[model samples]
Target chain A: MKTKSTIAIIGSTGNMGSAIAKSLAKGSNRLLLFGREDTKLQTLKNDIHTLNSGADVEAIGCPKDASWEADIVILAVPYAAEAAVAEEIRPYVTQKIVISIANPMNETFDGMVTPADSSAAQELQKLLPDAQVVKAFNTTYAANFAEPVIAGVPADAYVAGDDEKAVQTVTELVQSMGLNPVVAGGLAVSHTLEHMQLLLIQLTVKNNYNWHAGWKILHN
Target chain B: MFSELEKNLRQHITLTTDEFDRVKRYFVPKKLRRKQFMLEASDVCTRMAFVSKGALFSYSTSEKGSINVVQFAFESWWMADLYSFFTEEPSKLYIEALEDSELLLLKADRLQPLLADVPAMETYLRILYQNAYVALQRRLEETIGLTAEQRYLRFMERDGRLLLRVPQHMIASYLGVTPETLSRIRKQVS
Candidate 1:
C-alpha cells in the first residue's frame, strides 16, 4: 500500500526541486510547492497538475508568513540560502522530516566546493535543531531525476540522519521515485557521500562523461 | 587537541572499557619523527592510525609533482587515505608526520572485529566521516565562490588553532595556493 505523505518542496522552481515535485506527483497525491518567485511556483503547480491529474498539489509564494504544515519538507534552495530558509521556516516546522538536497558547490564556477568543518546539510541541521535533517538526493543531477534509471545503474540514493523514523520515511520516498534508497547511516555519514559526489563531479567533468553515473551499495 | 579528539570520538562511538582494552591490545604505539613518511603514494593504506600525540598530514602529488596537502590530522584524529584503505588501491596520497608524533596503529583485519565488537565505533566512524564531508563541501564552496583572500580569511576564522601549529607552506598547499600567494594574502588581510 502506498502511504500518502504530505510534502512541501521549499524551492520548487529550480531544476532539482521541480524534478522532485514531478517524481512525487507521479507517485503520491499530496504536495505543496513553495518558491520565492510567485510565477515559478504557479507554473510548477500547473505543470504537476497537468502531468498527474490525480495529484493534490498547491503552490505558495514565500515560505515567510506561510504555514509549513506538512509531513516532509524538502529544502531545495542553494547552499548559501539554506541558513536563511531554515531560520524563516523554523517556527513552522513542528514535526517534519526535513531533507536537504543542496550541495555546497562553489557560488562561482571554480572547481570543487564545500566548507572546511561542515556541509550544507550540517549547517542546516544546526539552524533547525528540531527538524530531522536527512541528507539525500544531493548527489544525483537534475537531468537524471526525470529518468526512470540513471545510466545502467538504478540510481541508488543515499539517506542519512540521526532519527530512525525520519530515515525510514525518506527511504520510502526515494523508493517511490523508482530509485533505490540505501541508508548510509546517520547524519555524519553524509560527509562520505558528499565527498563521493565531489569525486563523481570531478570524474564527470574531467572524463567528459555523462552525469548519469550514481552510487549503488553492493551486498554480499 | 588530543583531548578534543578523544571527546569527539567518545561522543559518537561507545566502547566498553573491556572492548577498549581489547582494541588497545592490537594497537602498536609508535613515534613518527618530523618529516617521517607515515604512508607513501603508490602504497596501499593498510592501517588506520589514531594520533595520541602530535600532528600529521596526508596529501597527494599533482601531475606536476607539486604536493597538495589534503588534510592535517592533529592529536586524537584518525589519519589515512580512506579510499586507499577501503579499496586496497594504491594511494595517490602521502601521509607524513608534521611534528614528532605518537600514534595507535590498527591493521584492517583487526579493525573489522574491533568495530564489530564495539558498535559505537561505527557511530564514531560515521560522525568522523560526516564531519570530514561537511568540511570538504565548505572548502569546495570556498574554493569556487570566494576570492583567494576570502578563502584564506575563512580558513583562519574556522581553524585559528591549526594556523598556529601547521606551517605557512602546508597551509598554502591545503588551500590550493602557492606559498607566495598565501603570504601575499596574509599581508593584505592583516
Candidate 2:
C-alpha cells in the first residue's frame, strides 16, 4: 500500500531540496517546507502548485516547528550548513526519520571534510541520538531528480540507515519519485555513500558529463 | 498518466470526469526501468499494476532452466500475480518490465473500497474478467486439443499486434514449442 505522510524539507529552497519538493509534490504527501530564504520558499511553493495544483505544500518559518510536524524530515542542505540546522531541530526530530543528503566534500572537491571515522549522516545521528538518520540522494546531481530515467534506467538512489522501518519508508519514497532505491546498509554505511558521491563529483569535474551523470548498476 | 487507464475503462463503461477523478485517487503511480522485476518469485504481490506506457511480460521458470511465457501486458493492460494478490501467498511467477514503463498501481486494500464506491468500476472489471475468461478458455482448448500449427494460427489471430513487439523465443514459449519448431512453423505458415 502507498502510505501517505507529511514530509518536511528543512532546506527546501536549495537545488536538491527544491527538486525533491517538486518531485514529491506530484504525489499525495503533504509537505512542510522550511528554508533560510522566504522569497525562494514562496517561489518554490508556487512552482509546486503549478506543477500539481492539488498539492499540499506549506512554507514554515521555524525548522523545529516543521520537524515536529512532519513524519519524515529531510535535511537537504550542504554539509557545511547541517550542524546549525541539526541543533535547532534536535528536540523536535526525536524518534523521527531524519534524512541527511549532505556530501562532505573538501574545498578542492577531491576529498571529504568529515573526519575519517564519521560521515555527515553519522555525525547528524550522533547529534540527534534519538532520530533515525538516513543517507540518500547525495549520489546524483539535482538534475536527475527532475527526470530520473537516463537512457532506459532510473537513477539509483542508494539508501543507508539503522532503522529498518525508516529505510523502508525512504525506499518507498524513492520509488514514488521514480528512482531505484537500493538499500546499501546500516547508518555506518553512510561513510561509503558519502565517498561514492565524492567520486561521482570528481568524475563529473574531470570528464564532460556536464553534471548530468548518475550511478546505475547493470546486472543480468 | 491515468489517461491510458481512463481510456481503457471508457471503452467498457462511460463515466463523467468527476467519477473518473474519484477512481484515479485510489491508484499510486510507479515507474520501472526495462527488465526490472515488479513481481518476482516467492514475493507476495501487494498491488496490481496497470501499464500506461511500455510493455511487460509474466513468466515462470521450470527446474530445467526453461521459461514459460504466460502473458505480455502493454499499454492499458494489467499485470499481477492474482493468486498472490488475492490469497496473500508467495507467487511463483515473475513480472518484468519489457521496457521503461509508467504504471498506476491499485493496492489490494483499496480494491474493495474502489469497487464499492464506484459501481461503474465494478462493471468495467466484470466485463474485463468475462472477456479474459473467454480468451483463456479458448487458449486452453487450443493448447490441449489442437495441433502446433493450429495453436500458432490461433495465437497469430489473437496477438498479431505483439508479433512485432515480442521476441520469437518468448512467443515460442507461450505456444509451448521449441525455438526451432517455431521457426519451421513460421516458414511453413509463410
The sequence of per-residue lDDT tens digits that candidate 2 reaches over residues A1-220 is 3224678999899999999999999898879999899899999999999999999789988887787657689999888988988899875665568899999888999888899989999999988776779988888688998888877678899999988878998999988898899999999999998898899888888897887878887889
Q: Residue B96 deviation, candidate 1, in Å? A: 65
Residue B38 of candidate 2: its Cα lDDT? 74
TM-score of chain A of each: 0.90, 0.97
**Tens-digit per-residue lDDT, A10-117, candidate 1:** 888888899898888988546778887778778887888898888878776566423343557899888778888898987555335689887776744343355666
Q: Which stretches of candidate 2 lie over 4 Å from their true place?
A: A1-3, B1-190
DockQ (Cα-based) per candidate?
0.01, 0.01
lDDT of 1 at B180: 99
| Per-residue accuracy of model 2 over B111-159 as CA lDDT, tens digit each | 8989987888989878866776776788789889999988999888877
What is the number of backbone collisions in each predicted candidate, taken in the order shown?
18, 0
Judge candidate 2 at residue B189 and give its lDDT: 99
